[model samples]
Target: MTDKLPGLHMRIPPQPITERSTPRPVQRPENAGAAFQEILKSKLETSTLKFSGHAQARLRLRNIQLDAEQLDKLEEAVDKAAAKGSRDTLVVMDGNAFVVSVRNRTVITVVDRASAKENVFTQIDSAVLTD
Candidate 1:
């Protein structure tokens, strides 16, 4: 300690700037939907992380029933296209898919309907888009 002025004193600490190396990790709420959207966007831009999943019966069945028949306000994309004199415009797609839902105003986790990789592909592939 050294006296600099009449009522002031200074003390030197023993730490140097170069010695500090590690950085603190940041924590954030897990937004699965946002994450998935980002992933899809990236996948669309770049052909990366492409893999097939096994079919799950429930997911397949759900796909078939999801927009199979839209009675009024809701219009089935595939069905509508097919009915509206669409030949090449009508796209039929069948792919196994994994359904995941996350609960949270600030998402923390994703609840997956398809447990495994194979199941995802299978379910999505089994889901008939048009035929």
Candidate 2:
């Protein structure tokens, strides 16, 4: 007795493997390292802190303005927080408080001194006080 399932029999022919007649030589740019360095430098130079929509709104609502120097200091604070492996950080510069996400290099929110005094900050792993 032969046991077989009731189904159509489908068969496919096997393909033959073909070898290339001539092996292709690997090509590399002569100034690859220098090109990569240029790219890295440009990226580092252009990199800056980003503000979330909520943070922007808060800044506008509070009439808060950040000058070039203050923004630079805030970026430095975020870098320090990142070095310390902080995910969320509270950064206080001048009289303003900023909640930053170190990994994202973004300002999550902003609070003035008056509002900061009444609010309790949460979900932050570190705090940076910068001048």
Candidate 3:
């Protein structure tokens, strides 16, 4: 005879794993740098010069070490940018939310907002993402 249980089912639904929630797109390690460089070059060439047919602005990402959580955000941003076919993509790590530049590989336009100091991170474009 089978024992009776009020709320027991033969099968149980699987719970989502917290670790697997992070976005990790399959990328070839060798292709990452090349893709990033190509994107950067295209952006520089197509964008109109601010004055005298010359561009005087260049964005640079600061070197800051990132933890697991921050790294996840970066992965998400890079994934979105790559998927969008953006030749000039910008990956913004603002607080918890991540912002991406379509295809540009530069950290442009930083306001230094007081609220943006949620976390210190090493900002990396796709060039650094794959590696």
Candidate 4:
């Protein structure tokens, strides 16, 4: 003898899932580029010059010292180089030589009196002899 059981449903149909749409690119204002350029120019005009890390290290290694007067002269020399549109410049003051990047306003290297005497400077477009 066989026993009969109630009907049970086991198989179900698979359902499809919806996907999200791709995002569009953001749009900028028409004058955005001009405005950004103006802001950059203003910031550059107000920023003070600086010395690069390598320059500082060279100064320390050579035991070179710069008095207040010498500092002022170096600033003036950088300004002069910038006025001439020089990107790389050599600034000479009181037997010391400094390699400056005018656009970035940074002193890239230092040559003490002894090194300056024998070294031939290159890769610089202009030279400034500071008082």
Candidate 5:
């Protein structure tokens, strides 16, 4: 039986253990959380508004021009609509009406004051007036 297991009786020499070099200290920014928060805030503010192709074309065809302030208001309106769980919303700001898809944060169409006078807005769950 012992002769049949000759190869299984072989011994392996152990290697000496060496001390490992200490790892370098990881340097982290002191205000990393604050920096991340600031970046998130800026991104949220800048990416708030998005216009669809139809909305852009409607705006151009209607000769509607929205300045920075008006755009900010519209964005705020969309935010409010989203907060209230609105999927489709009608946002009226500065006499301009915008049909917004709250879930996508996109403007589907624009209606100027003149066109909005007697036009009916459909498929909207909520309306936000930012005037």
Candidate 6:
């Protein structure tokens, strides 16, 4: 060590700067549009539509009967509801009422013509009427 004056300080070395590498591309599901179209088409073509447990019970209790034509109308209503980004929808067909889940293509509840007279639908984002 060399002799130095009082209150002297030592210098430190600097760190090297490194370039960052490029990030990898993000992964996502393929054929989203095709999948949506396929599901919609399948639902439209089916002879019958699916109902949730609560809806089934309500149908039995309310004596609501849906013929093939009525089911087709319901499917069409659901297709339109899905198109408009409706998650929960109220579909009215021939005086009957249905609460549908658009994303899952399911009818969550049902109200017959008689019950529908005084029914007030809630928690639905959209309503479609099939005359």
Q: Cα lDDT of all candidates, in order?
A: 0.32, 0.89, 0.45, 0.86, 0.89, 0.85
Residue 105 in model 3: shift from native, Å? 8.2
Write candidate 3's Cα lDDT for 1-131 as tens digits. 88889898777889887765778988778889999988976665454312111111212233234567765555555555665565444344642223234344333333223534664443433322222
Write down the TM-score of every candidate.
0.16, 0.66, 0.27, 0.64, 0.65, 0.68
List residue ranges in candidate 5 displaced over 4 A: 1-46
Give the C-alpha miss distance for residue 128 in model 3, angstroms. Answer: 17
Off by over 4 Å in 1: 1-3, 20-35, 38-131
Error of 1 at 40 (Å): 9.8
Misplaced by over 4 Å in model 6 are 1-17, 24-48
- Please state the error at residue 71 of candidate 5 in Å: 0.9
* Clash-forming residue pairs, model 4: none
Winner by lDDT: 2
lDDT of 2 at 5: 62
Q: Candidate 1 — worst ten consecutive residues by lDDT sum?
A: 100-109
Residue-level error in angstroms, candidate 6, position 32: 9.2
Candidate 3 is scored at a TM of: 0.27
TM-score of 5: 0.65
Tens digits of lDDT, candidate 5, 1-131: 54566567677999999999999998999999899978966765567788999999999999989899888889889878876889999998888899999888899999999988889999999999885
lDDT of 2 by residue, 69-107 (tens): 899899888877876889999999999999998877889
lDDT of 1 by residue, 1-131 (tens): 95468765666889756766699887766897799978965543332211123323443444433343321111233223333433222123333222211110111111233433343232111221432
Error of 6 at 18 (Å): 3.2
- Counting clashing residue pairs in each candidate, in order, gives 15, 0, 10, 0, 0, 0
RMSD of each: 17.1, 4.5, 18.1, 9.7, 7.9, 7.1
Model 3 spans with C-alpha error above 4 angstroms: 1-64, 95-131
Question: Where in model 4 is the C-alpha error above 4 Å?
Answer: 1-46
Model with the higher TM-score, candidate 3 or 4: 4
State which candidate, 1 or 5, has the greater lDDT: 5
